[model samples]
Target: MNTTPGTRWDVIVVGAGAGGMSTAIFAARNGARVLVIDAAPEEGGALHLATGQLSAAGTRLQRSKGIEDTPESHLADIVRISKDTADRELVWLAVSNAAATIDWLLDDLAMPVLPEHPVRGQNHEHYSQDRYYWGPDLGRSILAAVRAPFRELIDSGAVTARFGTEVVGLVQDPEAQGGRVTGVVTADGEEHHGTNVVLATGGYNADPALFEKMNGVPAYADASYRFARGAGHRLGVDAGGYTRNHDLYLCSFGSVLEHDDFPAPVLCRPVHWPEMRMPWEIYVNVEGRRFVAEDEPSVDVREHALLRQTDLRRYIVFDGRMLREAPPMIPGWSADDVRAHAGRHPMFHVADDLRTLAASAGIDPDNLVATVEEYNANRDGEDPLGRRFRPLPLAEAPFYAIRVQGMSITSTAGLAVDAGLRVVRPDGTAVPGLYALGELLGSGAFMGNSFCGGMLATPAMTFGRLLGTGILSW
Candidate 1:
């Protein structure tokens, strides 16, 4: 099922995701023959599952909304969120190009943001203005918009898309002077040569074993792109690029995964922590004790606390009152849906008593019972430790508990690159003809220490645009 047989090109992009497509488009449009290859049957990598939140400063959208922002402000926000651990120059590059790149995506690429969007902030945090936006299906909208342009390129023979093809290794011309990569070898032993190769393959979150090896934390997440096995990293390192940012592995909480597969579906979504879903429910750590404010205002605050816990596992304890009074906490689930899965949802372990519920949920029976009793007693504001956020207590129950684990959808650790998006070796020599975009460069590189706005999608697009139109030109 080769889309283009025996086709050589000026540039070969090793993915069909956002960054890969952007590179191919710009390269082809600039009179360079480009070949796009991907392991997926179609375009769009993690974009299909992404929330598509992006933050940009000094854009037309910001001006329209009467919001004051600049590239400096954007850089400040990214640095603050990353606690100054982010690379200053790289962050500047991504932030500076955000507005223009986004504009290009919306105009030429047909990207549309969410309707009530450009919100100051939503799931992540306040970005200082109404610049955040995503389409109805989030990442899917961005993917759809970009796909048509690439299709035109494919039809014109300027871009060759080879889907269901894996790059087993990179091809280097040692005798061709200065060790420049010539092309890549696909899994089926096909060598498609090109002048430049762009590695847009995503992160390694889907491969737990590899992720755990890179980052010290165990890969408890079940929500990353399956094909993001760090194939690009191996090829990059094999060709002399150095990997960095393996220290900043982060996780998200409030998910009740039923099993251990990567990218596992949420069996029960807890809206209690971020107050996105009200804290009509209380959370207990594996020790059967309340660890957080329950209804914390900042997602970072909650995520930080969850990271300290064992294996990122926690249980949600809610009473009949919350079940009846609060809005359906889980996104996409109605109260009726909760009722239908009353005894069936694996996380929805219910019992007549606190001890019984603890046993069913694999929690310490006595510790859980004491924790509940203590919480109930403190409902009157008698305690001083500042543990209860609502002080509503969990007394009125057909006591129910659900087990949840913290997981991630993108790679946080990656190779360290210069502001020019060049892959640098250990001795600090820039590897010519080698460039990395998207998750292969690592999520922490752009978004910093946290998911600051839409750093993942935005940086990939921004860099791809920068390289396609400028870097690869000379």
Candidate 2:
């Protein structure tokens, strides 16, 4: 749909991802005329690549399995995982409405969720209850569910979606009106007026420069949606919204990249979870010292440990014996493929001894040898770093090292918003007619300093639904 210049909309949503679509659909259903603008050729921003993982308590799916859960329990789990760093009121809002949002998708939109879902998630830290869920097709499935009803609204003229339209600036009222947002100006130099504006343009992980600037660390891999360039952040700031949670930046472990260069695209993420597959090698930092337990049960601990390493990088040190006997370190990689990549891949190094392997992998040679020797000597006793699983020793010839870097899939800092999802200034006053949700609020707002299962996507949808369904005055 084409957005005519000077057209007045009840709500102007600056993105077409999960958050914006939810806002548009619900607002249209509520008899509000909505306009959704996106810079991409299509809608469904990060949802195209998102895992679509979501968690909620008191859902019918959980009840069907006789799993007793509550919003309180969900809040508790997130607070515990985030170490009380998450915004309590905002988290309460998300958790309390999460089940309703899921039900809206399942019963109203006919979204397909896995039959045996609400399982305890395996990727991030595990929640105490089985409230995690995802569709077989991942984010696409969730997007499809939202898209169907959204398209119906568009067809009926309740909503107008303009793809390839980028919102360049937010139109703010004069100082007498507290500088409230009036509408938005697009990159095409068209002004569209609206009663309220919602920013859902996702995160900044795809923009290496912005990612490094915001998080104060280099983005090792480019693995997020390409359009996530922090447009919402910049626009919100221009309209006097204060950003927060910059210090909450954290990275996840186990991403194998296509190259050793900065901002390299991820080739694949190896399954390093001990429960899924016991580790057959030791993980060492640049100084060749063991950091976390190779078989650490908690993914959160392992990820944080990796963050403390030099340059947030580590080397998975193993030997020829491990290559032959243990499970393949790279999931789905064949033995021949592993052998081929050992010397051929830029991230992989193979040498006849620990010293040579360290040299090739840029690790301290003496420290690498000493670390391996200590592990070999302690095979009969408790291992350092509290490692419980030591399946093999690096005693065999042809020691190998695979370089891995800690990386993030989302931006941690973002525009600050209140419990009502209204963008706020540095003094904690609300910016009238302005709202923010999704990754525009930053992964740190909900997930805090850690990765809470299903925190990001679910809250984005919940806040969008709330804003669209009369949470904001027209």
Candidate 3:
């Protein structure tokens, strides 16, 4: 393939985060002159706001620990966890090539996991095998790990990066094969031509309007990477690529948002994992009804139950006694500290009685009183929701309610792509010279309606490695 005249880059990668950096690094190493561009002042994309959990089977660390695993088993878990809703072909592609990607991170990149890693993480549905891993520093560790190699490439001039630069449009030829994407035009009105253009822009979680438009739910938490505002999604759609998996949107039980706003920053995450801590409090929806069993063991069950609620929100309701007698509901904040915030914070509401408490927290007052009455009456016996951990009742006075909103940091809808990861048309034909990786591919493609451990980050880098190694050609 002959290089285009006046085209300064072999591959122009937009969004210099995990997938983009990995692509640029390996593409440059493979002898392609790479150009990296990002809207943010620096790279690291979602990793800055991510937990950076990585899942892989048959990695060097697993082998060292005598833990035998395979992509087949990993895929089996994903299918089981996602209820067979995930895209099989794309998932297989990522899983089959995942081990080498993890090995590269742990061995070649010198990134180390926690001492007792490879555990079935508790946040999401646990994978059957112990294959999930992350470093102590979480997302930042991955940032540090990938940045070293990317920095080396940057210093060597094999890769050229422009920070604070946004790719406004992709230069395409309608006459070419399937709207061939030849280059990208930056916001500054400068065209940077390349043989290939990769859209690795993260997700739409930070954009409330786009989040509601895409997922059919208002973005409740502004916890995603700030730069993830659907630039990649719009770009891909404009380039003749379609987005899919819109129906696979799923949210966690929730987090304590800082304000009553539609989209607010997360103040603190609740330790709602029953495995980590059993519930002494009850969760009531806006209808003031106990929807799911508070002591539900399956995280998936809890998440789905919350999904059916009115606003993907739940109020953690408890009595003053539950606060004093039970384990601390919210970590770092004790009973006294919790009392300090009651009636002061918008999220934390307190009342002398159940009706007042409900009204204060925007709950149905009469329904809340009835719900609490029913809950207290069935404290020692069988619960309607089949909740097993009913150690105490919501009878104590000065009732409290802390509002928690269910939200997702990753966008569920993403650009449609073929197994080779080329952004594809609705007819499943690849758009020439256009490829998409990472969250731009949507978490739904990997985990479907469920959040599988490490599926997002692992596959992002793995697909990047695959494309850089051999998939992409000039």
- Which candidate ranks first by lDDT, i.e. highest? 3
Ranking by lDDT: 3, 2, 1
CA RMSD per model (angstroms): 2.5, 1.5, 2.0
CA lDDT scores, all candidates in order? 0.77, 0.88, 0.90
Q: Please, what are the lDDT tens digits per residue for candidate 1 over residues 1-474?
A: 233566567778998888898888888888888888899888888887887777777777667767777889878877777777777777788888889977776666667876565777776756665667778778888888888888989998888888998988988876665578878899998787777788899888777787888877767656666688988888889888878887777777657777655446656555654545557677888889878877677787787788888778888887776677777777788766766665686667877788888888878889898888887777777543354456366877687777888777688888766777767788887666777888888877776567677888888888888888875333
What are the per-residue Cα lDDT tens digits for candidate 2 across 308-411? 89999888888989989988767788767878888888888999989999998999999999999999999879887888788777899888898888999888
Candidate 2 similarity to native, TM-score: 0.98
Q: After superposition, how far is residue 256 of candidate 3 from its true place, in Å?
A: 0.9
TM-score of 1: 0.93
| lDDT of candidate 1 at residue 62, scale 0 to 100 | 64
lDDT of the structure predicted as candidate 3? 0.90
Model 3 segments beyond 4 Å from truth?
Answer: 1-5, 472-474
**Clashing residue pairs, backbone N/CA/C < 3 A, model 2:** none
TM-scores, one per candidate: 0.93, 0.98, 0.97
Shift of residue 218 alpha carbon in model 3, Å:
0.2
Model 3 TM-score? 0.97
Query: Model 3 over residues 191-258: C-alpha lDDT tens digits?
Result: 88887888999898888999999999999888889999999999999998899999999999899999
